[model samples]
Target: MNVELRQVHDSDLPVFYRQMNDPESLRMAAFTPKEPADRDAFDAHWAKIRSSDAVVRTVLADGDVVGNAAVYGVPGEREVTYWVDRAYWGKGIATAALRALVTEVPERPLYARAASDNAGSLRVLEKCGFRTVATASGYANARGAEIEETVLLLEG
Candidate 1:
C-alpha cells in the first residue's frame, strides 16, 4: 500500500469518527474518550483540534482515507499519535504514516504512548525511532480499568 499523509480534509472527519468507534480499535488504543458514542462531544473535540495549530493529517493508503496521524500539545512537550484502521493492523501502515508525519513536521523530541500490552503499536513506535522512556499506569476508558501504559520519546 502506498501509505502517505496529507492535511486533514473536511470530508475526513466522518471517516475518522467511524474509525474511532470501532470496538477493536478502541480496545487497542486504550486511552479514549469515555463516551465514544457521543457525537456532540466527538465533534467538539475534533473542532478544537482541527482549529488548533496541531500538526494533524489524514492517513491515506493507495489514496484511501485509512486513518490519521498528528503531533499535538505544548511545543517542548509535543506528542505524536496515529491510528490505522484495525483491518490494516500488522500491515505497517501506522509506522509509515507516523514516519511521514514526523518528516513533514520536522520538529523533534516527540512523545508517544501506547497500552503496554499493545505490542503492535509499541513496535510501530519503536520502529519509528521512539525509545521507551517510562511506563505508567492510567485509567483506560476503553479497557474500563487502570492499565500499564508505555511512554516513548523520539529525541531530535
Candidate 2:
C-alpha cells in the first residue's frame, strides 16, 4: 500500500464519518464522540478542528482515502492521533500515516493515548517512536464505562 498524507478536503468528511462509525473500530478507538452516529455533532466537531490550528490530514493509500491523521492541542503539549479504516488494519497504514503527520508538524513532545487493551494502536504509536509514559482511566464512550488508557510521549 502506498500510504501518504495530504490536506483534508471537503469531500473527505463523509468517508471519515462512515469509517469512524464502524462498530469494531469504535470499540478499538474507545475514546470517541459520545454519539458517533450524530451527523450534526460530527460535522460540528470537524468544522471546529478545521478552523483551528489543528494539523489535520487525510490518509490515502494507492490514491484512495483510507483514514485521517492529525496533531492538535497547544504547543509543547500537542497530541498526535490517527484512524485507519478497519479494513486496512494490520497493514502498516496507521504507522505510516502517523509518521507522515509527525514529519509535517516538526514539533517535539507529541503525546498519544490508546485504550490499554488496544495493542494494535499501542504498537503503531510505539513504532512511530512514541513511548509509554503513564496509564490512566477515562470514560470510554464507545465502551460505555471507564477503562485503562496508555499515555505515550514522543520527545526529541
Candidate 3:
C-alpha cells in the first residue's frame, strides 16, 4: 500500500479517536489516556497538541486515513509516537510513516517508548533505526497496572 503523511485536518480526529480506542490496539499501546472513550478529553488532547510546537500528521495509506504519527516534547528531548489501525498491522506502514516523519522533522536523537511486551511496536522502531537504550516501569492506563516499558533512541 502507498503510505503518506499529511497535515492533520479536523475531519481526521474522529478516525484517530476510533483507532485509539480499539481495545486490542489500546492494550498493545499500553500507555494511553486514562479514558479513551471520553470524546471531550480526546478532543482536548488533540487541541493541545495541534496548538503546540509538535510535528503531527495524519497517516494515509492509499489515500485513506489509517492512523497518525507525531514527534513532540521539548527540544533535544523530543519523542516519536504513532498509531496504525489494527487491520494494517504487519504491513510496514508504521515504519514508513515514522521514517517519513523523522525525515520531515530533521531532529536527531528522537526518542520512543513502548510497553516491553509490545514486540510489534519495538520491531517497527528498531527497523526505523531506533535502538533500545533503557527500560523502565510505568502505570499503563490501558492495562491498569504498572508495566515494563522499553525506551529507544534514534540518533544523528
- Tell me, by lDDT, which candidate is best: 3
Report lDDT (Cα) of residue 148, candidate 1.
99
lDDT of 1 by residue, 15-117 (tens): 9999999999999999999999899999999899999989899999999999999999999889998988888888889999998888887787899999999
For model 1 the TM-score comes to 0.98
Question: What TM-score fits each model?
Answer: 0.98, 0.99, 0.99
Off by over 4 Å in 1: none
What is the lDDT of every predicted structure here?
0.92, 0.96, 0.97
Cα-based lDDT at residue 87, candidate 1:
82
Residue 36, candidate 2: C-alpha displacement in angstroms: 0.5
lDDT of 3: 0.97
lDDT of 2 by residue, 1-156 (tens): 799999999999999999999999999999999999999999999999999999999999999999999999999999998999999999999999998898888889899999999999999999999999999999999999999999999998
Point out where model 3 deviates above 4 Å: none
Can you rank all candidates by lDDT, best first? 3, 2, 1
| Runs of candidate 2 exceeding 4 Å displacement | none
The residue-level lDDT of candidate 3 at 90 comes to 94
Of 2 and 3, the candidate ahead on lDDT is: 3
